[model samples]
Target: MFPENKKQLKLIYFNMKKIVAYILLVFIIPIASKAQNVSPLYKDSIQLQWVNEKYDSMTLEEKVGQLFIVAAYSNRDASHENDILKLIEQENIGGLIFMQDQAVHQIDLTNKYQTASKIPLLIGMDAEWGLAMRLKDVERFPWNMTLGALKNDELVYEVGKQIGVQANRMGVQFNFSPSVDVNVNPNNPIIGNRSFGSNPDRVAAKGIAYMNGMKAQNVLSSAKHFPGHGNTDQDSHKTLPLVPDNKADLEKYHVAPFKKMIDAGVQSIMVAHLNIPALEPDPKIPSTLSKRIITDYLKGELQFKGIIITDALNMDGVAKMYPPGDVDYRAFVAGNDILLFSQNVKVGKQKIIDAINKGEISEERLEESVKKILMAKYITGLNDLKFLDSKNIFEDLNSDVNKALTTTIFEKSSTIVKNDNKVLPIKKLKQKIAFVPLEQTDYDQFLTHLQKYTNVELVNVKNPSEINLLKDYDAIIVGAFLSNESVYKPYKLSDNSKAIINVLPQDKKTIFSLFTSPYGLKDLDLAKFDAVTVHYQNTKEAQVAAAQTIFGAIGVDATLPVEINANLKEGKGIATKHIKRLGFSAPENVGLGKKNF
Candidate 1:
């Protein structure tokens, strides 16, 4: 391996098929049938041209190397030596994507890794929200669900720009982010907060805003899990999830944000390991390996001319869904431009080589993708960027801009659901208050915050039979912040929770303030409680929002996105507007939905 800095390679990078076309056109130049043309590399390098003069100057191996992206580590020690050097030298891989685990070492690792390679690497990460999401030793902003309540699209965009800043500081070129999934299913385990919200148009607006923010900082944004991974009941990481929906549903909900971002000039699209029956029939074949969807819908119809990358092939979604014959080869055939994180590169390389030898995957397709890969490198100014600038990276990595950006988002999202009798702003509660802390040890901070507002009565119902412990106060407010969603869905009214409410004097006034999802309201007897307010998130902002709304200090009208009842009708508390609204208003009072933990 040539371990010199910014290593240069003597290899070709061009679309062999396009080159052949030009050649045949050249041979027919008896009457001068062609314009003076340039190479793809030359075209891409200067002024971001597609048909330039330098493609003709590169070698065959350079083009092949550009099509592959190898998984690499940034460790300075020899721990990263073998795989990093082998791929960079033998494979001439075009780029690297850092995992949270891969970036634990210092930033100096970039110089060593880049020097070992023959080409300047374009680095990327799955830093959806920020660097803190994946990498350890970094701060995490609020998750996406809390963010959805915030109405400030600009804040969301700023988050992207800040993520780009940190990533770029660490030598990353792309941020695989702004997960455009519209989270309609609350039971969706993987993509809940990862999504912007439950509305497609809202997600689209946020996606465009975030993309613009990323573009402001020159980071290529990728809209991922194409089609949409929000409504499915299964986790792709475990098995291929088949999202059965008609074209109308897809266009209306799932494809809305993708179309918006593609129009906004997103640089790449990362395919997910999902099985949409309407798009392709292969029960086991994910969209990452589906030609019908990737080529027909994404390329032809959408007209996206940039690169297409698959999510890590090592993910169980691809591993369990694919067979042993190097599914990446199938992915290439299906129109993916980069084979990201293939579990075994040797196997992947051999399979692709065998396919080329057998002529099953034409060399023309390979060359086309290689040209795209090179074009990305050339246009990103990878050759111009100083990837190893370590002078003040530690101080600049997580700049103050990120903390402010996160704070902005949290501020806008806090919302207030309902205030039946204008008891919020603490004037009403504090005047004649009895804070019945939902007596649970696991949530000390939640109760500790509850204590700041009112006097507490740790109401513990010894048994259902012992119920009069809650009778003395003029008004009762229950503080139940530690409840989880699963604990409420099948809906069990906590015997103790109901017991406390049960013992309250028949003439005394009482209310239930659910701090998690309003679904907890279903667990309690809603009819029995005099006034009920549901604040979906329990963040301090949510609490404050709920508090303000309860007293008319903030207007309380945020519509609940999920069902909060088994009462009125068969499908009672389900919000009908959420199913089809482009963007729905949350049960907002103050900006409670905006804060993140």
Candidate 2:
């Protein structure tokens, strides 16, 4: 027993140390977990300590800087990067909102920006549908209108979770998304496809699911254009669109979803730059600058305890009405905790500082917002900073899982509003069908997929008299490929094309396939067609899904997200049971033994 045994003694010492460490971990892990579980808005003990300590250490200039979130672009040159760096170092700006960038470039820039800041920066993106909205080559999820068509709210939740996961992958803290503007106005220049649907209750339900899903991944969601931008005829980016509804109608149609989102504990609300005389008596004052709208109503009446953010200060909606720093000061005084995309950060910060010195804004008021910003950063896990490793990031962002989810979303969201005489799921594969594209556009994918089930002829036509050429086919499938370049672009058919469409069903069994926003349905006469199917976008996935639905490879479960006309109201969809005749598969299923596929 007295012999020296170095190896055995060392092993015994290591085991004892491990046992002690395990005992410590047992107590420490739960405490950390519990702290993390606490809502940042609630300001638990640990969060309060960090928020207060950070607030106390900051100077007035730094406190003022914390309220401004300037825009950043990875796609820009070195001069832009240097400017952003200057803001972080000199001005001590609060955060960044990256726009229109490449995936790898954005990630690398995020790390560089985060490393340069004295305090952790809160990175956000306008990724309403996903990063594809602002970043190139990322997985593009379905638009909110597409998601609104789904009967299952859980699917929409999964979409939000996936978007959040991708945002987190790129080291982003916030996503300005789930535009809960119940799009009741078809003439709305923006917020068409961005909104879930026209139904306020449905919009609120989907928005709540999406918000919760993002929260599950620690990403903050901001419900936008509050008090609603749904009923405006003009784009807020261009002018201060007047929301003309009375207070009761505004509450019923436009503001209902925002109220519901507030009730559901959404982390942020972006005040719109709209002139609503009903909510705010002053017709000249936009909601973003009105204390009655933001402070008294949203914060006081509705009791929204979360951070209030203003829409971009550079937009003409508010920018044209005020000078450079004036708009930011007004939004701040009105109750917005964060001023987004300020035209001049230097001037804005100076203006805010001036207000504080003149006693127009109390130091206590400034401290409240600054502390709230710090708490948000802590909640996003910025207290313990970790830079993103760019290895396989592009591939990881557009993984197989993302593609599969997208395919399922498109398939489930293919809606058929009318099927006169039940002409859908064309059972006779041997019938002579002509694929007529209404516009002078590409329909190769649609035509090819249609031919997968049966032989179809292509009819190229320019005039209304071309309807005569389609008389040879047993049935006619008309495909309208509308441009999705911008929401402001015209989605209606030309006069000549419209004439052909109206006359085609009178003589032939015409099936209309629309691949664009549902708002365009107002221009069309739905009652004239024998069958109508809507695939919301012109992507290849939508094209293939539209073909599958026509041939009965998939059934129709999606309903109209927005009301088109009096006849085609919201929730108008004809659910089709899947027929056994056709199934979707690889070409190999019939490739080997094919006798003309």
Candidate 3:
């Protein structure tokens, strides 16, 4: 009898320890979930039930409306609002993709649109680099090309997570991003900086991280321009770009990333308006409207079960091919779940209705897409949707955390391509250094930051006649800045700029820093420069990071994401050891203890 009491006491102690462990587990899980990916929405029973219940209550016209995601803009006046409202009221469109607008304004319009619609509207944006891509004066992450150079995909995940956090705060449901295109072509007018890199493996790894990061915040992501938008010389917005690669080569290079994305359980894929004869037999038909490409291949062959969305139907790649209603019908028949940026919602909805009525398209087909859209809405938390409290949204979106993360990304992505004779880190502080601006934009931040480490003289020479003035310095640091980093803009240096760089004095050690895409390095002979660095962007943070790296405050780790030429191929980077001249310390330790600078 005494033995029984002792055994019971031992069991109680074990149970107490288990309870403590359980409590710790609950608290620690979310903290360690930064790298975790969210499960697919369609797999959840509760969301499916909500979808079924909502689908049962919908009329045929309402079901048809769920397929259309129309374009919306906050930059417009009451006329635009009234126009969008009319479509919501009359056509019952399912969603809105906000284009260009300020952060607060977009939130306000989102609230107004959601209230006006009978069904809670799904809001989407082309925020590949966060809302800063569309909105002004907001927090911005680096482009995909910059991110591709990063050795740590975790940093890319963090970038995606931050973008997701900001997007969720603004009530955006979908981020039509992570263009999983492999940029094999240097002259790709559209996907130059938008793509991760030339390597399919690198693109896939980065795309997976980005997709998972957004998923963690319950924001749906679409790996876009599927089949792949990279390797095309022309912009799809202008015309249908041709991808001449055979099936095996296409699979090896362009389509590889998309396959990886799908395998990684990407929630959706946006079909590109590309013409690939290897995949689609008809050259006239773009992938967006091809049954063989979308239904047979992407859906059947790839076994992708997620939502298939079309690229903006208004783009010239598909828009010029057919009229509004006809093109929308073909896209639906081709098996896209969402028709994005439909040219005319009214005509498209009516066309689908007519097709359903005539038995050309079954009611079951309509139900499939409508139910899927409803499931997405429920999964994105639209069922318990709360109107955003805009009082501190601007401040929240541009928080210290956002700025710090962006600065960190800039630091990590800076790459040194050439450092001959161990000339980097500018070890000789006693040597006279001249800061030359080979840019149309301002280089004040770069110059100012350079002065923090050592004495530097500013040299402004716009033409060859003024170049003689630079002969006095022991070393010349040239900042080749690109003001407009747009893909449509010129990335190559001007003839005059090239002439000045090429003719720089051979006697003086010349170190060149490019503040633009690595593709700009194509024409210039990089051999002349004793040391070279590619910072990718001309932003203040990038400028500061470049300066720090030059002075050995930070070491270089990022590699070239794309090939500039045969010699400067992909994955080329010079890893420089840190000098620790500007090391981390407390403010007081550095002789500045005041709270305000």
Candidate 4:
């Protein structure tokens, strides 16, 4: 049961059914599993002795099936439900990870699947920041980039707590998130903004704090892209990334945060699709398939007893390296417990079946991985909290309290780095001012709120020349927003936007409002702009907060937790504005929070 966004969910269901059918025909070698005379609900730790004994009784076919965690869909048209049932009935596969779209109707689908298979599936998610981080029609919190700014680790825990609540309600047992990668490279297109921050200590602390909330909620969390994937410019989703660094570099900059996370009692670590010569010199193989790194380093050196899961098998990084079926075989040998997003479940099952028959992949190894996966299941309480009545998330998600915390973080963070304005508290609210929105839809709702305090003219500026409206107003307030989005990089006013802002009347006051991450300020050429106000998100709250700061309402204690440039030290966001409306009253709706509160 994917999102009622029926079109995409149905398509995913289609592929799932087809894949399940293939597994059924070849690998449905039914082997009856006698329930260990153990208690139905495992209260304490899953008795390792009983589990090992139970696993020993499983037939060869059942053991092999335990290694596969196939993707499935709910569309009855493809009818893969029976295929999954056959495996549970026969092979006893481990778990399933949902995609962005698979989140919809997840509860009912899981119920139906569990009823057919008679085995509880360890449901997983790429809830990197939260479940909504990837899914549509869901509430999306700010990226880790914004969280990195506030330096409030407790907030991360709150976020994790909320994530656990939402995900658990949807029957999710594991959350693959709190990317432990310390972002040292600004140019790192993929992990920069997703990381907590650049400092190893901070990244470690923030990651641990977030995990605190998750673990407290009993949500299984997996610290990911082992060794660290934050420095590479390559998107492994497209091509294999190389972490070409020496052991010292890895230990100092990259591995530090991960070590911190592992120490924090994390339940799992996801090996990246990286090729690092320091750990595994063979560029021919990815970390996901290299025993040298997976077993020798991750398992032997780090002593991570928890399950090791591979990133999505469909990713170009792994897909290009091995055929679909072989990826499963190699990943198992590499010590991974789960073969995520196994693109070819049918062929993959047979490969495992063959690997075991030929002794290429030992049955002992298969039992080890499967046992860990299942143990993880018992530990996560999935056996007890199976399927909750599905809630219509559209209304229940993103409550007002959550948005206020986001507002406090973002608004208090919009520091004024440089303002010659003594002109900022603009002396005259009676002055005509231009409201030039940076993006086509930049805080449109907040613009209406600006009318409450100011006697000003709001001008729509699509091109730089639109700054001509600057002639009519005494001061120019440029609501220029930027992000890590590919197109927005190397941000500049452009020919037309620049020409207009540059030619602004020198006699009049000018204030530049930067509503994206502050790192974007480097591209703005601070010399031309008289004042800079950075209200992190482009959310309506960001707009309202930024405008109020201009008029002096809220106290400004906001600062950057990370250094943006050589001149800007860590904790150096410019103190630009203060709150106008008084009191600590919460907003009616959090999703629209602003800096003005």
Report the number of the highest-lDDT candidate: 3
Could you give candidate 1's per-residue lDDT for residues 328-383 as a string of tens digits? 77788889988887666556667777778788878788777876666666655665
Kindly report which residue stretches of model 3 are placed more than 4 angstroms away from their true locations once superposed.
Answer: 1-39, 484-487, 583-597
| lDDT by residue for model 3 (1-597), tens | 333687898988899999988876886455334212333446455666788888889889998999999999989899999999998988889999999977788888888988999999989999998888888778678889989999999988988888889889989999999988988888888888888999999999999999989888989999988999887899889899999999999999988899999889888899999999999989999999999999999988987777889999999999999999788988999999999999888888888899999999999888877877887898789999899877898788886666766777788898999999978988899989998888666787889889998899998888887889988889999999887445355677888888888778889888999988999899898877999999887778888889988989888799999988988999999998788777432344345545336
RMSD versus native structure for model 4: 13.7
- What would the TM-score be for candidate 1 when compared with the true structure? 0.76
Superior by TM-score: candidate 1 or candidate 3: 3
List model 4 lDDT by residue over 470-496, tens digit each: 776777777765543422244333455
Rank order (by TM-score, best first): 3, 2, 4, 1
Clashes of 4: 18
- The pairs that clash in candidate 3 are none
What C-alpha lDDT do the candidate models reach, one value each? 0.63, 0.85, 0.86, 0.69
Output the better candidate (2/3) by TM-score.
3
| Backbone clashes, each candidate | 32, 0, 0, 18
TM-score for all models, in order of appearance: 0.76, 0.90, 0.91, 0.82
Off by over 4 Å in 1: 1-58, 73-81, 102-106, 321-325, 353-364, 389-398, 436-467, 482-597
Q: Candidate 2: lDDT over CA atoms? A: 0.85
